[model samples]
Target: MNLKLKEKIRESLSAVLPITGIVLMISIFLIPMELGTIVMFLTGAIMLIVGMGFFQLGAEMSMTPIGEGVGVQISKLKKLITVLLTGLIMGIIITISEPDLQILANQVPSVPNMVLIITVALGVGLFLALALVRIRYKISLSVLLIICYAALILTSFFVPKEFLAVAFDSGGVTTGPMTVPFIMAVGVGLASVRSDKNSADDSFGLVALSSIGPILAVLILGCFYKPTQAAYVLEDVETVVTTQDVARIFARGLPLYAREVLIALLPIIVVFFIFQMLTGRYHKWQIRRIMIGFIYTYIGLVLFLCGANVGFAPVGAYLGKQLAELSFNWILLPLGALIGYYIVKAEPAIQVLNHQVETVTNGAISVKMMDHCMSIGVAASVALAMLRVLTGVSIHWFVIPGYFIALVLSRFVPDIFIGIAFDSGGVASGPMTSTFLLPLSIGVCEALGGNLMTDAFGVVALVALTPLIAIQLMGLVYKLKTGKGTPTERAVIADDCDMIVDLEEDE
Candidate 1:
């Protein structure tokens, strides 16, 4: 009923309309889908669009500012114990609120969801403290990544092969819609304390570091237990008969999401309320605006999840199964690659991230450029993942080398890119990877008699990994073009690490 809410709904519908049209176009001309399925797809599309709109707006209003506010307040404190406790509490609370993590937790049969959730939360909490320490001490992002990854690779050999992908995905998905905006905002708020130009670079590696924690924790868990079974949880898809029925479907779906998201969102709302009461940091109007934003986010997430889980997820699974059942299972690779490319356009956290990168870099890293990098990164990861599904390739073969190249490249690229590239790694694996792509992979694996837990589980992890290389490679390219000396000289460093500074003092 409110004007802003109405505009968000309209915009969301408009944004998703083209996607709906594409699906309809394919159904009518390219693929002959059942009419009931088509209706289901459309209904899901509407929910997804509106849900994304609301969720993103809500993140902006409620999550980002609150996280930033906390960061700013926490930074003002001098006690080390207080900072550590805050990080632990915030990490636990935010990770618990992350629906994507919960989704992954529910799917794994070997580990209890609560156990996995707690382990992942502890991983995040520990690393969040580390991230804060890094910011406080101004630690080099590249060096820290090198050490963390070295540990990851060393652990890979000992951990069970089946759990590798899920472990990596755990890293990426933990930093989800609920966690990212707040965490990133906290980074910015903390970084704002320093007058140094390079402070913005420090704002980036929170998600990057937080990401490492889950992989390590999950890998350790993998060493302890082996999961031979895959749990295939089928979602309930709604059947719509008429155009009018779409409204009724959304109406029914909305309240359920409203309840769930409101519950998910309540902890942060309460935290901020208490925070504001103690600090008096926010104005009355500011609080009012955030409340409105929370409403938008709540409505958006509810619709988004409902639509994704109920509508698109089933279709994706069905399509994968159908395609795998055909003689042309190989087609799944290229098709998955193509979908991975375009679907990046639809990921809600990715959109926010790309916009943030463009803003922070003063358009030096354009959204178009960032999108291209992510599309390529995601495309390659999906292609590799699809190939793994077809041939039962171990995800470690791809991830270890991919990370090696990224880590090596970090030493060559600018420090800012080092931070952004690693952050982009996690950002690439948003809700879409978990909800749509994972299910799609699982469907194909189930049809082909491949181990779904081993083969299909790590698509998100791979998606998270490739961007580390792609974005840093972008930085490598930028250095080659703009650096004062020979490319060969810049590429190799023997002792003097400071020789590679391109624009060290932020432009």
Candidate 2:
């Protein structure tokens, strides 16, 4: 247990260091921040590392097992109605509990928070059931994606321009830390039942499909809740001049987040308890471990939210505004790109997705490689987002072409890569992007007098979109590399099964 915790902390350190160092460099050389702000940012970075470590370990211990157990049990049931209903219940429960979704719900002022939350949760439930059906029936992921996205695009025309970016952002944020681990594990559990060679590939794309649902649902809601513009109000960051002030800030924020995290976690815990009572799936020891995991997850989430909202968010906004106000405001593009590249590595959900992908592919796709690809993709997305902020370009100019390219590339990449690529899109836009990057973009947009809804709102969507293209491009390269190989030879090239074994033992 101690070893696993240490490993998680080590992973978080590696992920957090690059971005923290970059931020410090930027503060020193480019945009000079207040000493108080710098202190807060550094403190937040420390909390992020510690919080992510615990959270990832907790997820591995709890969410993965519960999701997989539920999935496997549901798959074994004979009735199709039972399977679909189980999925619907699970999806709604999980989506409602998602911390990222709650952040998003609070941001959009036009819709009531509960109304929007319920709408998005229902969408997740419905589509999650459809995803299950797709897996069972061997439905083609690429074809389903094309059809769903085509419909989403067509619907976008009817949605008010003010709501367009928000609609897409909804999709990206819905598949956050709470949702991703559980949904991906559910896919793995469902796929494990199949004997076919493609079953492993099929264990992905649930996240990809689930992401689309909220976009569609929200877009439909937009038709009715049309607003000329979204009203956004940036919160003021209190100055912190001393270590005591910083401690006070975190202390004040912690209890609020503690309450929020408890509220967020309660429903899921209840669901798990009911499921266990009905099925008796877990042994006594496993239950104890999972309960401990829940405690870790609770503490981690509270610390993470307190640190991120109190410390990182204000700094992100301040940086964006300061950079954009420069004599050469265009520098925000490259700087934003650089920050995006490293910031994604620090996202808790991204780490989970990378580890899962490495495990699923038996290290054919190394976690290092996945991290590199996601970073590049997010870097490009931030560059484009910054460009939009600088030039006041319509988001459609980028998003339409981006998704078109992603969908088109879906035809050429391997099946597993398609799943990983789309899943990566959602994973890439977890809490970090929403809390930090979104505020950063909004700060820039406000400084530049750009429409916040159109220009700033789509950063998360773009963050989600780019990975779809980048990972698939990696897939295309991978495909070409093994094109001439026989089946066994291709298997040998595609997986490091022996190496995976050694790595597991080392762990």
Candidate 3:
């Protein structure tokens, strides 16, 4: 293998191992899972590590370049209408092809899968156009966020209560692995055209704003079509009694996921080719490299989704069922918190966000620090979610207050941190949250006889919420410690340069 692939594998191992070890410890000491289950879980972990390595490499090679190229080309057009139209088209196309959105649509049986998918796609498309406009006009990200969220909360009051959690969740899942790298890179490319001091800060909020679009769209749908109860049918895990059964299980799953991934990627590949043909942007060698990257992405997503859905999800549900049945069910809260702390690291998109943040900041904010902060944020969110399940607390009790605090914090933090915090909220809730954590919550809710829609369904929204506050708080600390010197110094330097230019002109 090449050295770059080796390095990616090593990174994947570090991210995956801790979570696997946590599961093993829980199985041995607390839950005592079946030997067959343990074997299957281990097998899945290996696939996850390998899959993540390839996916990360492919994203760096293909998604980043494609997004940046499109962004730069669109910006160069210098026509607001052209930019808006391009954003709308690209956003809908990409959201339609997101694998996670497909999973989310399947879970919502009230709306036809196609209907939900299209609604969410339209939401993403509209808001993505708004985001590009915001960057072009140098709008205040915090103000935009506050207004959007406030409107979202107000809209929830008119919708059926059952749809609230799902609406918020739509916001979270829309910014999944397929969407994040591409959307973020587009922001970077858009910002690259500007020579302003705040351009870098502006690039960070595209994912954050894109997340909001889904919430608003879903809420509007809720006003029209109300479901009294969510129609969520949990998938049954097939029993595996031996190593051959484990192999058989994965083999059976492989083709299904492979097909799904291929369907998800086809549009993206078509878009890339169209852009290449129209712009002649990439040379033959570069095109060849991108094609190879697409292959890696295809294989990686197939393996990753198969491992997550077939392997990790069943075990998560099983573990939740077992734990909730125990004499002291309250233990789920702390245990969930522990799992959340480690599990965020395993999210492929979280790694992408962390690395991007570090790179954008020129290592001013290290990846390690971002990782630690996200872990704490996610841990708090999960613990709160588990508490809601155990006590039958309404999601609004937590979400309303949680978002209010996050919005308030946005006012105090540096502008860049505000954008990062909101974006992190979306990134922190990725495939692991959907496949593993959502199933786990559903299992516990089922065992506890709680309302699945009201109790278990909002975990993704919560997972997406706490990170906003945690990351902004980190920014607040950095601002306090550093005395906000950078922005201030830049302003002073700009003033001096202006004065010198005037003097030279006068001379």
Which pairs of residues collide in candidate 3?
none
Taken over the whole model, the C-alpha lDDT of each candidate is: 0.79, 0.87, 0.86
Residue 347 local lDDT, model 3: 90
Candidate RMSDs in order: 4.5, 4.6, 7.4
| Alpha-carbon TM-score of each model against the true structure | 0.90, 0.94, 0.94
Candidate 2: segments with Cα more than 4 A from true spot: 484-507
- Over 101-211, each residue of candidate 2 has an lDDT whose tens digit, in order, gives 878787675888899999999999988998998888889999999999999899999988888888898899988878999999999988888889998899999999999
Model 3 alpha-carbon drift over 4 Å, by segment: 485-507
lDDT of 2 at 472: 80
lDDT of 1 by residue, 103-122 (tens): 76876669888889899999
Candidate 1 residue pairs that clash: none
Evaluated against the true structure, the overall lDDT of model 1 is: 0.79
Clashes of 2: 0
Better of 1 and 3 by lDDT: 3
